[model samples]
Target: MLKLDAYPQGFEEDDRLRSAFTRNLTLHFSDRPAPPSVDGAIRSAGVPKTLIRYWHDPHDVPDDVRACLASWDRLHNEGFEFRTFNDASATAYIAERYGAQQLKAFARCRHPAMRSDYLRLCFVLAEGGFYVDADDVLLGDGWRTIFLNGTLKLQPLCYDIFSSGMVPAAEIWRHDLPTEGRIFYVNNDPIAAPAGHPVLRRALGRATEKLLGNDPRPEIQATTGPGNLTAALVAHARDLAFAGAPFDFELLHDWDAIAETRWDLTYRGDARNWRNMDALGI
Candidate 1:
């Protein structure tokens, strides 16, 4: 029952978080359709039985990532077809599928992480399926439950500035959580959606416009990372609420219990990790 009257100091002192959390709360309580757990997922939905992943370079994958990727095979056994893309292959796919505009935007991405962020949106929008980060590993076999519908499944995230860590998932929905030090949003990874989902279209279009802008190097997170996705989700939720329609997306909970990113991957210590890029102000 933690609540606050104002945005506490050291919480970035911004109003966006408060408004963002208010919008997110609506989706959480709405009577939007969700998967049924007892009978398992219905595979007849248009979302393909495919799992997509990407890396900038194919030949130079680190051992840690290889091990993590090996774990994804368990999902393949569950009938999920897997595909891995490198920079070259990803470029080719975008050019062939989305035409010149998206290809130019892909070229605009300055880093691997940015490229990955942008590409996932395109792949998911053009062809319905699941997209995961390369370093993520599958921990459970009950993933079929997520395929029950065409709704975009994204993991909701909340950060506590006061504690300098994430707020637990179970507690983020409480009406009394301290608002001043908390920021609620969503992650882009592990995206699950049917083809032509409006949220993915919005995020991809946003990233494309930012990358094509005058900035030689766009801000990674705000341009194509979690921030971009969060903004799109907020906008979509607002639109749906205003239209008196149910939400088109679902908030994924306990995803870490099924799959998680291997934080110890060697590349995380170097320039490859987007957090490092943010630190160097690149």
Candidate 2:
């Protein structure tokens, strides 16, 4: 049921294409079991016991990445199912699961990182589970608590524009963090949610339209990464508040301790990393 309409005749008709895309998503999700709700509040439970990760090339994983991948693999004994997809396989999977339009949108992604971002949304939206970046390593059994609830769990992040650095995780909780020099966004990694999450739906739709039809090649962050997710979350919260409904989600704390991204890997300096692609004009 995935779809977007052709509108080459005029760019002003982009809004119509977006509407078509959302309508298609509605048709697809309408058939799925809605997330558990009680008394106008979404209760997180019933999330599937699946763990998904992605890398561009599954055939040639690096040594450092193997260590990080092993951390998640060790959880297999703890009743979690670990699954992986590569660039080619990810395209095939989306094509089979969501049909032609979704596959076309996935093809629009220019890098493996963006593909990973979009695939997580597609997988979790359709199949309710957990998706973590391959670079992140699990520290301990604390991951159990994250899977215990079906609510979407995202790591919160704040960047200080003035200092050109990230604010410490502990201080990101402060109410005054939204000042002029601060930018608040949620990390897209470690996404845990039940199927049919409204926030996920919004993010997916926005990301899709941007990839397939937005003016100017959309920037990587705002188009598919954390910026898209944060925008969707804030918008969903406003909608819920306006309707007097409860907003349901959890911003994970101490995630730096539970699981952290290993920054010293070989790919960090090469074009394999998206930041390098941006800077080196790859």
lDDT of 1 by residue, 138-170 (tens): 886557667876788888777888899998766
* Overall local distance difference test of candidate 2: 0.73
In candidate 2, what are the lDDT values of residues 11-87, reduced to their tens digit? 22243333332223223323334223233222337677789999999888899998998988766775677879899
Clashing pairs in 1: none
List the candidate 2 regions with Cα displacement exceeding 4 Å: 1-44, 176-178, 214-216
Best by TM-score: 1
Report each candidate's C-alpha RMSD, comma-separated, in the order given: 4.8, 9.6
Error of 2 at 151 (Å): 1.1
Candidate 2, 174: how far from true, in Å? 2.0
Provide the TM-score for each candidate, comma-separated.
Answer: 0.87, 0.82
Of candidate 2, the 10-residue stretch with the lowest lDDT total is 3-12
Worst 10 residues of 1 by lDDT: 1-10
Can you list the residue pairs that collide in candidate 2? 44-150
The clash count of every prediction, one per candidate, is 0, 1
- Shift in Å, residue 244, candidate 2: 1.1
